[model samples]
Target: MTRRICISGASSGIGARIAVDLAREGHHLTLLARRQNLLDEVAEQARAAGATSVTPLAVDLTVPEQVRPVLEQAGRFDVVVAAAGANAALAADAQTHLKGMAWAAWHWEANFRANVLSAVTLLEGLRELDALAEGASIVLLSSIAAYRGSGSGSYGGSKAALHPYAYDLAAALGPQGIRVNVVAPGYIAETNFFQGQMSEQRHETLVGQTLIGRAGMPDDVSETVRWLTSAGARHVTGQIIQVNGGASLGH
Candidate 1:
């Protein structure tokens, strides 16, 4: 049957791919992101991919007030994919002389806001607006860095915070037949995450770490998410599903 789904970060990368994948199943979708132009492009792709309906909403997840009005008008959702996140440490090297320890602290704060709080604010608004349907599925995008650490300490630290939060939310929402889970990915290539900063050596190193001997594509994560939100994964909740291809084995 067709379901009503909401996906944040739907402008590009895994989020856009997920929206299109689900759209092929003819589901109704609400796509959210900060880029209006990109969101519109994704919406067209979703429609072409076979989505029964599509609504694109441009809003910054960092601001709670902006999200409230959107949630208030978007109606209820049966599935929510919190795919918005960033690695703020990429910009840290430019400000290395910002006093004692401030640089490190800034990295932590920026990542927390981008990764953790962005999802929190959206989910919180959904709860307050009573916009989640019964038996809804919620998936938060995380990284294997949460376990093995990333170039930026704050990136991994921020993602790690989601594990316990998912567990707690699973318990709290179980009574209402709502499920919450996480997907931790590693070294997914072609994503905007690296921001064109990935080098050949680093790319080779990450692929080598994977037993599968290949870099992950957007489909690697999106397909996993598709299953998690489907009826096949009805019994799965509060678990961290890793899509790292054995890269986190050392963890």
Candidate 2:
């Protein structure tokens, strides 16, 4: 059966790859992102990849006011992948930035809005719009940094909040037949996560930390998400699947 999937951050990286993968499987895709040009590019590619239908929605997730209107317009969907905030992971010198309480507060708010509230706003809008189709599945993007205290304190803290939120949401939406899950990825190269922001030394450290001896790709996370939304994962919900290649073990 064809699926209607709505994905945020669909302009690039993991989000774009996820949209394309599902589209290639003949799913209808509604792609949302901050950049209109990027979204259009992804949407066109999705159609070329065999998506039954493709709709591009350009909106920034940071501004709470912009979320609902776009999601409302996407209409109903069988799956929602809240994959926003790939680029807002952390600063090169996050430890220094975290020295002051004001900076700490700002970092916390920034990460929270980007990583948590963005998904929440979309969920709330879907609820209000009655847009989540029956047996709908929701996937929220998280990170291995959020699991172990090895990266930006603010970024991890913001992502940590998502675990409890997902658990509660799974229970809250269960009676309504909706399932919520979280995915925490390790060092992913396809998203250009380490470019310019992380030093080469730090990059080597992260790579060595991964048992797989390499960084993950956008497709790594996308495949995990695809499974969660598939019929095979119907029994799976409120779980966190780490795509870190065993990096968490070292952490």
Candidate 3:
């Protein structure tokens, strides 16, 4: 059934693809991002794809005050996808390991704020709608890196924390008819996520690790997200569904 959905990071990448896909399926949407121009462009694409109604709210989710008013105005939604994220590369040219510690710390702190705090804040806001709606589903965008701590340090740790949060949320809200789950994705192409820092060799290594033998697309991740929020996945909750093309299988 068509329902109202709110998606953060909807201006691009997997989130944008999800918005367009769901709109084609006739869902009304609220697309949130920090870039107004980009959000408007995405909304237009969703409209062209047959969205029932597409609203764009551009706000920096890192700031609570900015996030509050936009969420309050958006009102109730059947599904909420928290997908906003940022990435910082650890300086690999350090003369000594200790020299890079400060840089890593800064990057880790920023990643935690963006990935963990943002999702938690949004979940808190959704509590306001709990009494008004029969139920709601939340899909948190995590990373395959969450399964095991990686070189990204804080970025991986932030995502790892989301697993427990999702599990606890599902258990706590199950009686209230709410479901929470996580989508841990592997390598998705055509996003500004890596900022083109990945080398051709690095890309090949990532693809080689995946059983699919190639990098994934935005649609690959979005399709799983769409299904997870649907009644078809009603029985599934508190699980971390990996969309990693068979990479990092054991974890």
Candidate 4:
């Protein structure tokens, strides 16, 4: 059956792939992203992939003012995917290795705004808008870095914060037939996460840690999200499903 889905970070990487995959299943999609051009591109791809309808909303998830009003009018959603996130330390360049409390504090705040509060704002908007359908599933995209130290500053810390939040959200929404869960992926390739700074040695080191002897791809994570959002996973909620090819094995 087709469902109405809302996805953040739907312009690229795993989020984009999930949108297309779900679109192919003939679902209606409302994509949220910061870049209108990119979001439009993904929307076209989703349309070509057989979506019943696709709406692209360009707004930064970190800005509640922008997110709330837009979501309030997009109609109710049967599924919500909170996939917008970034490593502030990496984005700021070389800040991850710096050794200063002040630097760490700034990095933590930036990462929190991007990773933690972005999702928070999205969910808050949905709640206030009454945009979540009964029996809806909410999936938050996370990283194995939350479980195993990435040494990339507070990226891991921010993602770790989502776990407890999902647990509480699940309990609160369970009676309403809504489910909340997180999908934590590891070493995914073809993503903008590395900011084009990944070295060959770093690639090998990451793959070596995985028992599967291969790094993950966007679909690896996206497919897990697809399943979790389906009726087949109705019994699952408030859990962090790791798609890391055994890397860190949830530590």
Encode model 1's per-residue lDDT on 31-93: one tens digit a residue: 999999999999999999999999999999989989999888888999999999988766534
State the lDDT of candidate 4 residue by residue for 1-251, as single tens digits: 98999999999988999999999999999999898999999999999999999999999889888887788778999999999998877784545665788787878888999899999999978888878899999999888989876695589989999999999989988999999999999999998888887899999999999998999999998899999999999999999999999987544
Error of 4 at 194 (Å): 1.0
For all predictions, the C-alpha RMSD in Å is 1.7, 2.6, 3.0, 1.7
User: How much is the lDDT of residue 194 in candidate 4?
Assistant: 84
**lDDT for every model?**
0.91, 0.84, 0.84, 0.90
Q: Per-residue lDDT of 77-178 in model 3, one digit per residue for the tens?
A: 889999887554432332233346776776777778878988877777667545224578889999988876667678888888888999998888888788
Q: Candidate 4: list runs displaced more than 4 Å.
A: 92-99
Candidate 3 global lDDT: 0.84
- How well does candidate 4 match the true structure, expressed as C-alpha RMSD? 1.7
As for candidate 4, its clashing pairs are none
Provide the lDDT at 213 for model 3: 98
Residue pairs in steric clash, candidate 3? none
TM-score of each: 0.96, 0.92, 0.92, 0.96
Model 4 compared with the native: what TM-score? 0.96
Worst 10 residues of 2 by lDDT: 86-95
